[model samples]
Target: MDSFSHAFIIAIPLLLAGNAVLVPFAVIGAVIPDIDGVFFLFPDDEPSRYIFTHGGITHSIAGASLLSLVAFIGLYLLSGISWFSRFFPEGVTMMAGLAILAGAMLHILIDYLAYPGIPLFWPFSTEKFTLGIFPGPSLMILILSLGLLTLILTGRAGVRHYKTYLILCLVIFFIYAGIALYANTETEGRAIPTMDPTRWITIVETDECFVVRPYDILYGRGEEISYRKYTNITPDELAGIARLPQVQRLCYHSYIVTAERRGDTVILRDPLREEKVFRYPLDHSSLVIPLQETRSGPLPKNTDRP
Candidate 1:
């Protein structure tokens, strides 16, 4: 799941346990597990600090348990209360620590369904156990966490008033996903033409692509910018495109430049551009042709994204 969704999922339990004031702390606790992956910020760099070690520690059940125990002990001693009394009679710190541990544990559990699974019982075994489904583990986290949050919040009478908002959010999200899926699918789902790391561009049918501005919220959707059929390019040109350093850096494993044929020339369109760029005599697979480039401007239409 996205960060917002992950945080919301962790915050819900804290919200249920404490009031609004504790939500931030709970979110911090939840995000602590992921802090080990700090190298994510410098994805291209090797031997980055915080990547080699500390990844599974905070994310593991054992690590969270240790933190929880430490919190319990620290709270008891700081408050100068008997252990039983601290836990039973006035268990503020203990409960708070448990909330933190719960957040971390939940983070691990969510990552299990992700591509590279987390070690629930670390130190027992170093082997990773993943669900091996989607490559984008964050996406699974986003959907499930948000869904659970919606379900939990829906069950509460006080939050019932916001049910319409939640439903609206879901509807809008699927609408965008539907369009994005359509764009990618219709275009043959190639890596080069369809994948957008920034998610600003979504492939529609061949020769057509839609630009969608991403959202910042858990279930928020983006607005689509439709780029109508423009020009056609040949497979050789697409292959040449795959050789480019920029495209290689961006899409990587999921690159595909799909072309649709028309009349004597194979027309290729730049889905990201406003003007049409054409490619002629689309055949002769050995010939490598350069794709045309164009400038972009403000969209002709306006729509809400975030």
Candidate 2:
């Protein structure tokens, strides 16, 4: 889950718990798991470091629990000091604890529905559990948007208390997510017109940008391309790629290309960067007609000889 969803989960609970004053802080704590995104700000030496995956430490149950404990202890301890004690107030210590716990639990809950599951019981166990609620890229945005809107409308119009709103929103989120998941399952084997894996090019159309990913080898159409939250290539790999005349001339402006490993060799391709895109893997071997005639036709072929 991204920051917006994270905030929604946490804030909804806190608001419902009658901790409206702490909603903003709860939102901030919920987003702590995504601090890995800060890696994008600095330049790296190789492509491997560029967000290999998300939801490792911060999205773990340990992280969320630690956040709850910190909020509880820090405020409790600070309550002793007069100048730093206003946040705790007189009768709100229990409310604050409940708020923190609610926020932390909600954070983990939202992440469970994402592709790479969060460690719901980290330190105790490191297993990842995913509900696979939505596909990467476009489907995620659609799902999250619907969830957020439902939460807002139902919470505001129907519920009188924050707790009621929180439960209602969670209910709506799960129901809507279930429907979206069913829809994605239905489309798994369906043909997507613009995407053909046999061709060297991958097309990603969004509201803001249209991305095209191309295979740069002498004759290799990129294999098994999927839309993912994190990219395999780091800033260093992107810079190295930019120096290549073939990539610069053909792909730099169209798509953001990167390399990932299969067995030993690294294959070049464009990744589905955001959670708002869809991936379609084309099977070139299944094609009866030449690839050059369709939408993403005339792709480069793998020419490395044995």
Taking all chains together, each candidate's TM-score versus the true structure is 0.38, 0.45
Q: 169-286 in candidate 2: lDDT tens per residue?
A: 5675576565544433433322121222222333443333334454322354344344431234333333333333333222211123334433333344433332223332111111
TM-score between candidate 1 and the true structure: 0.38
Candidate with maximal lDDT = 2
Q: What is the C-alpha RMSD of each candidate to the true structure, in Å?
A: 14.7, 14.0
Q: State which candidate has the highest TM-score.
A: 2
| Clash number for candidate 2 | 13
- Each candidate's number of clashing pairs is 17, 13
| Model 1 per-residue lDDT at 294 | 18
Model 1: per-residue Cα lDDT over 147-223, one tens digit each: 66666677853444234434554564455455444444433222111122223232233435443333322344356
The stretch of ten residues in a row with the least summed lDDT in candidate 1 is 297-306
Task: After superposing candidate 1 on the true structure, give the runs of residues whose Cα lies further than 4 Å from its correct spot.
Answer: 13-22, 39-55, 67-92, 140-306
Give the alpha-carbon lDDT of every model.
Answer: 0.42, 0.46
